[model samples]
Target: MNKVYHLSSCNTCQKILKELNLPASFETQDIKEEEITKEQLEEMEALAGSYEALFSRRARLYRERELNKKELSEADYKELILDHYTFLKRPVILNNDEIFIGNSKKTVAAAKAAVHG
Candidate 1:
């Protein structure tokens, strides 16, 4: 199954989900309703190169909560995400060993190619 971790209100998340159109094999975890496991978040962060990639710096949560990236430790990040899932980025798609952060044609194509290859 493909698990998507994202905020429901994010337009990018909606757009990617709409574009993918994979309802049967896909499951979406609303950031507000479902907390991503620390291990899962850590894996994605490593794959994307940083916790910043896993978290949504551009989201209203960041601005409204006044979350400064530089002030957070790795543990703090994990706790924050666990406690408040809305801080995560939109459309964080997890398919097998692959993870897609945000939606872009290049990212989609690359993920597909890698999976199919």
Candidate 2:
């Protein structure tokens, strides 16, 4: 599965995607317009190891809800991501069986390598 789960409105996600220069075979999903399906989320979880790995603590809702202070479990993370798009870390790139999550310089760099490799 060569796919990307990203927020089109986010500059970081856009920049990283452009930098990756993915091929036509790659699929891009604008998470804002089309919410990620449970099957898609489950597939990502399978590659990523856990829902918490795919969750974004940086989301505004995370702070607004004071989730930072809470001891959230895997189920909580999964539910939160399903509840709100922002709860998901941006630019989740799936290069075949390998999954990459987030937009950090390191993560983006790795994703670029995977896509271009």
Candidate 3:
């Protein structure tokens, strides 16, 4: 399955999608419009190895709510992500069994290469 989970309003996400130049068959899921289900999160975790890997500490809520002060467990991460879509890192690309999470230069480059090559 070739899918990209991203926020529609994010400029970075849009830029990455353009850069990816994915085929017409590629599926795009706007996380803001459709919240990610627990089952989907589990599937991502399975490929990503851990929920923490998919979690985004950069979320404004994380800092505003002082979530950084507390120690969050695996379950906490899952719950937070489920409760708020912003808790997830943007532009998560799932290409077959390989998963790429985040907008870092290396991750984006790797994802582009995987889809193009």
Count the clashes in each prediction: 0, 0, 0
| Deviating ranges (above 4 Å) for candidate 2 | none
Best-fitting candidate, scored by lDDT: 3
Per-model TM against the reference: 0.70, 0.97, 0.98
Model 1: per-residue Cα lDDT over 1-116, one tens digit each: 37777777777667766766655766778866766787778778867777766666665677776776458776766666666766676677777767887767887666556444
Worst lDDT 10-window in candidate 2:
108-117
Off by over 4 Å in 3: none
lDDT for 108 in candidate 2 is 86
Candidate 3 residues 65-117, lDDT tens each?
89999999999999999999999998899998899999999999999999988
What is the lDDT for 47 in model 3?
A: 95
Q: Model 2, 2-114: lDDT tens per residue?
A: 99999999989889888999999999999999999999999999999999999998899999999999999999999999999999998899999999999888998888888
lDDT of model 3, residue 72: 93
Candidate order (TM-score): 3, 2, 1
Q: Candidate 3 at 90: error in angstroms?
A: 1.0
